[model samples]
Target: MDTSTWIGIFSVSASAMCMGIGSIAPALSEGKALQQALSSIAQQPDEAGTISRTLFIGLAMIESIAIYCLVVAIVLIFANPFWNHVIAKPGG
Candidate 1:
């Protein structure tokens, strides 16, 4: 019922939402991107190398969004900025 308790609750819930929603979107995007890349490579065998290279770069960029979400979730769960604000109160 206290400030810290509320902070902990909110932080955990927020982290859960961040990870749950964030991971799904990127995973779907990566899957779609890979599928299209494969289709392109299959259609143009001679350009397989370039297509593969570009796919890797695109995948990395898309994956970065997931990585960022992970960082945010980790921070919310383990090192939430709001925790400091609540804990530093004079009567906390």
Candidate 2:
């Protein structure tokens, strides 16, 4: 295969891997966060509001990691800088 084909294959494989691996951590973290939040709420019913609010903020922050990975994967598959380099090269 040529360079362009190689880049295409790499891009697709990388994107798939990124998304597959990326989602797992967030899923786990979200589950764990929810579990801890619920535990805290159970332990301190009076502070449930604070604990829940902080949990939401923390979850949102953690979720941003997955979102960033998704954006990177999309860029790799659809807007790779290597594509420009490959296309611009002379004589294949």
Candidate 3:
């Protein structure tokens, strides 16, 4: 009901949403990438090493986005910027 309480609720909800969507997208992307990489390696056995190496690097880069989202969600939940504003307000 109060401003601080509302802020906390919204922060937690936003964080949860961010984490859920963020993790799911990256997981799906990683799975698809892996599948494609495997298919490529199978088709070109001679270039398996190169394909596999490139796959890993690309996967790492993609995974970084999810990690960043997780970090942002954690910060939102645990150290939200609006928390200070709401708490500092009178009768919050």
Candidate 4:
């Protein structure tokens, strides 16, 4: 009913949505990337080392997206900037 309550609800819901949607895309991308890398490696066995190294780096980069989402979710839940704004509002 209050601003703080609304902010809390919004923050939690947003964080949940952030994590849920964020994880799915990265997961799907990782899977697809892995599939492609594996197929490439299979086709060029002699280039396996280079392909594998690049695959790991690519996977790590892709995984950073999910990590960023997780960080955002955590910030929303635990350190919400909106919470300060809501709290500092004039006699809300």
Clashing pairs in 4: none
Candidate 3 residue lDDT tens string, 32-87: 99999999988999999999899999999999989998999989977788997777
Candidate 3 clash figure, as a count: 0
* Clash pairs (backbone) in predicted model 3: none
Cα displacement (Å) at residue 85, model 1: 3.7
Give the whole-model CA lDDT for all candidates, comma-separated. Answer: 0.94, 0.93, 0.90, 0.94
User: Residue by residue across 1-92, what tens digits does model 4's lDDT show?
Assistant: 97799988999999999999999999999999999999998899999999999999999999999999999999998888999788788885
lDDT tens readout by residue for model 1, 1-92: 99899888999998999999999999999999999999999899999999999999999999999999999999997778899788788877
- Tens digits of per-residue lDDT for model 2 on 4-77? 99998899999999999999999999999999999989999999989989998999999999999999999998
**Ten residues in a row with the worst lDDT in model 1?**
83-92
Residue 76 in model 2: lDDT: 95
lDDT of 2: 0.93
RMSD, every candidate, angstroms? 1.6, 1.6, 1.8, 2.0
